[model samples]
Target chain A: MSRQDAPPIYLDHAATTPVDPEVFATMKPYFTEHYGNPASIHTVGQKAIIAVDEAREQVADFLGCKTGEIIFTSGATESNNFVLKGVLAAAKIQKPHIITSTIEHPCILDTCQHLEKRGVEVTYLPVDKEGVLNTKSVQEAIKENTVLVTIIYANNEIGTIQPIAEIGEIIKKANQERKNKIIFHTDAVQAIQYLDCNVKKLGVDLLSLSGHKFYGPKGVGVLFVKEGTLIEKIQHGGHQEYNKRAGTLNVPGIVGLGKATELTSKNRVADSKKQQKLRDLLINSILKNIPDSHLNGSNKHRLPNNANIRFDKIEGESIMLHLDFEGIAVSTGSACTSGTLEPSHVLLAIGVAKEQAHGSIRFTLGKDTSEADIKKVLEVLPPIVKKLRQMSPLK
Target chain B: MDHFRDPHNMGSIKDPDGVGEVGNPSCGDIMKLYIKVGKNEAGKEKISDISFETMGCAAAIATSSMITDMALGKTLAEAIEITNQNIAEKLDGLPPTKMHCSNLAADALKKAIADYKSKNK
Candidate 1:
């Protein structure tokens, strides 16, 4: 039960994790037996409503917030859009400014870009070589007209954990000193699995998460909007989700999210410890055994289950294909942008050379990863790197 | 895997008649093709030798090897007829997304041939 006993080692948990069986079991009833519109005014509808209310409470309990604070969306992308656009639109301030780090997920960055064209001023703060954001840079970037500050809790490609608490504290102090209520948001989609997600503990007024990233069903995510956080409705529909988002609920997915959050809150401590050991072993062995290979991000401030590595004079796509031939699955970077053949923006942001960025590969461990998986990777990687190097033009 | 592991004609041809390099670093692929021109018994220009050095994915390397194998011993005119599809077919067809690699190989070969022709003229 420690590792998935399979041919292809699933080492891309940062992209998505397989749904837990227990979470699936909890979702089955909502799809079939308890199938009813939560908005209907009947007994079956009431039954569905009870299930939804319970799920809301579960997610709220996991995030340590009130039940009404959690709003379900199609996925994290929509949740992020809602927060960024909704806050700015509702603010109604002239030329409202926003602050975010350069290493944010595309949803945040793209949304910010779109908002900028509409008289919004946005500042993208750069991270250090290790992909860690400087708190002072964020403080300096906050203008008097800055309406919101959104930063990703952990980078998807590099697995760098930004100083979320420190940034939050700075924002809190800035709001008090300037008497400007600049809302703070963190896209915790990558952090929900192994990091502490309590809203109060992180001091984030708005947080975003996707179900699929944490062993839940896809197409469902939650955005934690703190009480009294003024936000306008992005989607117009009947009175569902308090009219903030208007659509019939994905009941099964919501149930799955609730269960996934509950399980992650309970098991993350032990899971992180186990994955950290495997991850360190993988990183150390690859660094020690392979020549001219380097780790991509911070050694200390990174996710427990992630490793981004680069080998000199070798293409990452080649390594991915060779590893695929050996029945081991990995990624060069984010799956969302895999087919584009562009070197990772995160790598470039961290000051990695373009040639080195092309050679970067990401290996993320999960709860099911085992000792045998690590052994297989160690045994398989060197020969593949060697073969690629022998064929490489630079080598 | 076969062509990628043991490419047909790899490495640079020393003191070659012409060289062609295709692809950019941002695309994560760069291919350099070198060729030697010679006169055949039929008094026609033929490619005496062809080799490639590729920094790319499996498909890119495979297509480079395949193009070199197809171009060697062929007349300049015949080599000029080679297309991305030909190189892909020679390798049992690459994925749709990877067809660009075959394009890079064919383009590099044509550039090398053009270089040889212009230099000789």
Candidate 2:
């Protein structure tokens, strides 16, 4: 069959996911019918307040935190900025410091750069060739002035799962020896659907997650701030969110996020198992059928749904466009796609050469992925790669 | 996007009169231009055929295809005068970020003309 007649396949779930139907249904009523300002004390407004509270409880339940600890924000970017700027703004020490990994999302890295301009010291720790951070590096980077440690739980590009719990334990021990407590934060936006994220188990004082990452609505996120963690509000306005975040609630988006979180908690284990199998099938098939193709991240410690593959001679953007023409959606680590003229920082951090990084493509599965999707990819991808390689001059 | 999907005049000409390569693999764009030179009715040297092989983005491939179409059958002097803007205009304009891809395409054509001149000299 011609590619124009084929059904489109979505393999870029790491970028964003479509809202779950159940989550959408749960959010529908709040948009028009139950629409009221949560700040209002009237019966109509009180309903919105109740819905928002329930969402907080649902998110809190999933993360094993108290309901009061959940603070709703616009999304993970805001949540991440809130933690970095908020904590440092409230720090009592002179010249506060933060330790973060080099492979963190741009939200974290950019926030750290913005903070650095204002005299806050930041140490960006490096990762291994497999994109795994050594817990000892985190321990050694902590100093007397270190006030916070933030890291990404799972990378968006390569899908390498960092050792967050081990790093958290190292911070826990470090905090015991210091007079000033060092707060631990993690950007868990990409890990919420496939990993264990209970705050207590992870030893995290602050955590950030976005709704759209896990089959929920966009423009809504949660920042888990432990009771005793010191953080000043970044957005100053009203008395909402216990004066921690000062904005009217997004009732429908919160409802969707809550429903999505509840469903993820219920089906995470099964979903991970299914995606891992399909992901392995896709990765193994491509490696077997295509010559000079290499996997980008750690095979054992990577996310269940992610497969980043690099071709020897062809550029990633060309391959991505070819696959897109074949009715498949995917992403690339190449500078051409990002408009930045620089390759993915995560891939570069893992020591992938610039040319190899330009040749890498990322395929992330989701709860809806099946064996048929893997088969379709297997059928279409080999030919596409071969064609692009034929047109490539690198060889 | 159309040019990217089905590029015109792809691949190299065997024993071509001129060959020009520009950009680097590490920069995420490398275009190699091949040209066949022949005499026109007026006995002036003109391009008989042109083709390209590129390893880059959709913009890069599309620009390479567009430049080949724009330069084919033109005299080397006319081909060298085809600017990056002309290629982008023929392709209905590229994104600001992708303008550099068109530049690389123009540079490759210029390099090919230079190679042809050096060979005949």
Candidate 3:
């Protein structure tokens, strides 16, 4: 069939999800009818402030936290930066230390790298073969000057869910014996959709999540800061977000995020069950049909919707482009796709060879993904792999 | 893009007169060129057939296919003159990041010609 005649199948949900219609409808009125600065004292502004407060309450309810603890920012990138830099800046010691894993998103890793140049000591703990962090490593890395322990709840590329609650428990136990209590932060951008995010249960002092990853409008996110966790403001400006994040609020995006959070709280169980079934089917079928193909990351502890597979001898960009021609969208860890000279750091940290990392593809299912879509991918992918393998010289 | 979708002159030739392989898997691209050298009507050594086996991205595979098509049935002297710029131009253009792919393609062809000359000498 011609490319124009083929139906487009979207399976790259880990990158971003389309905004839910209900969330969009909830946000519509705030954009036009209730448009006002929340900082103003006029009635129009009060309307905006009420909406923002309601949104904050909704987010707090979803996370099982207090409304005052939730500080909204631009997105998870800002929220991550705020937690890392803010906490370090507020440290009382001459040389503060941080403990984080190697699989965090670039925002967190780059921020840590930048802080290292300015005299902050950072211990980058490595993960196991399945991209799972060892809590023992975290406990070993902490020192008298250690101020924060930030880790990703679920990895972006491999979708391996880390043991955040266990790590949090370890920190809590260690804090009881020290004069300086260590703060635990988690970048839960990918975990908000599938896993439990109760702040009390997870024992996290701070958590960051983005709206765009969970079918909400972009440019809005939340940073849950437990009361009494010392963190100075990163962006200095007028008093906003309890003087933690200083900027005029994005009211519409907040409303959308609130609606999205409410919907997720209601439908998470059913969504998880459905997507897990489809994800397993996709993984099993691909592994069975393709030769020399294997799954990356931990199969048992991964996100319900993510499947990262590597095919021997064939490059992932070629497979991805071939799939694109068939009107299917997926992602790859190959350096060619990322416009960089190195492959995925997450894969590398998990012990995947550089050449093998070049052959990995990521398929992330979403709410709208269907059995038909999975079938279409299964029907098209084997032949593409075969053709590319025939043309490859890696055998 | 068309060449990437339906690559031409793919696969290696059996018992070819010369072979040239370039690139490494560490850099995420490897191209091997196979050439068959024969005499033309003018009694000059010419490339009668050529094919490539490449393991890389769309740009890498597409450039490999394009170079094979450009060098086939050309005199040895003509084939040796195929520069990376000419190969990229023949494929319309390549992204700046993928220009190295075209360079690999041209280098593979030149190496094949050199291999042929060394054997004939």
**Highest DockQ against the true fold, candidate:** 3
DockQ-based class of model 2: medium
CA lDDT scores, all candidates in order: 0.89, 0.92, 0.93
> What is the per-residue lDDT of model 3 for residues A22-57, given as tens digits with 9 covering 90 to 100?
999999999899999999999999999999999999
Candidate 1 vs 3: which has more lDDT: 3
Off by over 4 Å in 2: A1-6
| lDDT per residue as tens, model 2, A1-395 | 24677667899999999999999999999989999999999999999999999999999999999999999999999999999999998999999999999999999999899999999999999999999999888988989999999989999988989888888889888888889999999999999999999999999999999999999999999999999899999999999998999999999999999999999999999999999999999999999999999999899889999999999878898898888878888998788867877988988899988888889999999999879888988998999888788778877
Q: Against the true structure, candidate 2 has what lDDT?
A: 0.92
Per-residue alpha-carbon lDDT of candidate 1 for residues A1-395, written as tens digits (9 for 90 to 100): 12244567889898899999999999999988999999998998988888889899999999999999999998999999999999988886678899998899989998999988887899999999999999999999988799999999999998999988999999898888765598999999999988898999899999999999999999999999999997888999778897778999999999999999999988999999999999999999999999999999999999999999999887887888778777778988622136676678899899988878998889989999999998999999999998777766676
User: If you superpose only chain B onto the true chain B, what TM-score does each candidate give?
Assistant: 0.97, 0.98, 0.97
The fnat scores of all predictions, in order, read 0.53, 0.73, 0.74
What does the lDDT read for residue A299 in candidate 3?
94
lDDT score for candidate 1 against the true structure = 0.89
Worst 10 residues of 1 chain A by lDDT: A333-342
The superposed Cα distance between candidate 1 and the true structure at residue A13, in angstroms, equals 0.5
Candidate 1 matches the true fold with a TM-score of: 0.94
DockQ of every candidate structure: 0.48, 0.65, 0.68
